[model samples]
Target: MSLLIIRLLVFVLVFWAGWRLWQYWQGFQNQRVEEQQGKDGHESMVKCEECGLHLPSSEAIQSGKLHFCCSEHRDAYNTPPRDDKDN
Candidate 1:
């Protein structure tokens, strides 16, 4: 009976230790993911040249190596119809 109790205690201790280790590993992984997201979020902001609209860089339109708020503004600035009088 004493040997069986000792074995049970050892098993319980090992199980508890494994559970705690798993929890720590999960926490570490979550922290890593958050850090990566923080870095990406810092790089995400973009400023629009036309209207000065600040937004995510991924959603902005790129033209002539410049970022624009939308396609309409980018197109308007890119190819303005030439006026004969101005020419």
Candidate 2:
């Protein structure tokens, strides 16, 4: 009957719309998880080229491509080691 066919079509459309909405919600949840992970990844370990010390990137001194724990270490590393008999 024509009524039966119309009811079936309406049910199918509603089911399809619900499935699409669920898929969209799942995608949004995945995006939120990725953003949370990015924030938690802030701390990065870096090694001081001068003293062989390890520290977080945020606290490490950056000189060109090298990393140091402090300005003293950075300066010491950049300057050549002192020689005793050069005076």
Q: Which of the numbered candidates is closest to the native, going by highest lDDT?
A: 2
lDDT of each: 0.84, 0.89
Badly placed stretches (over 4 Å) of model 1 are 39-87
Report the Cα lDDT for residue 56, model 2: 81
Where does candidate 2 stray beyond 4 Å?
1-42
Q: lDDT (0-100) at residue 3 of candidate 2?
A: 100
Candidate 2 Cα RMSD after full superposition onto the native fold (Å): 8.4
Q: Which ten residues in a row have the lowest lDDT in candidate 2?
A: 34-43
* lDDT for each residue of candidate 1 in 13-41, tens digit (9 for 90 to 100): 99999999999999999888767657553
RMSD per candidate (Å) reads 5.0, 8.4
lDDT of 1: 0.84
- TM per candidate comes to 0.48, 0.50
Deviation in angstroms for 74 in model 1? 14
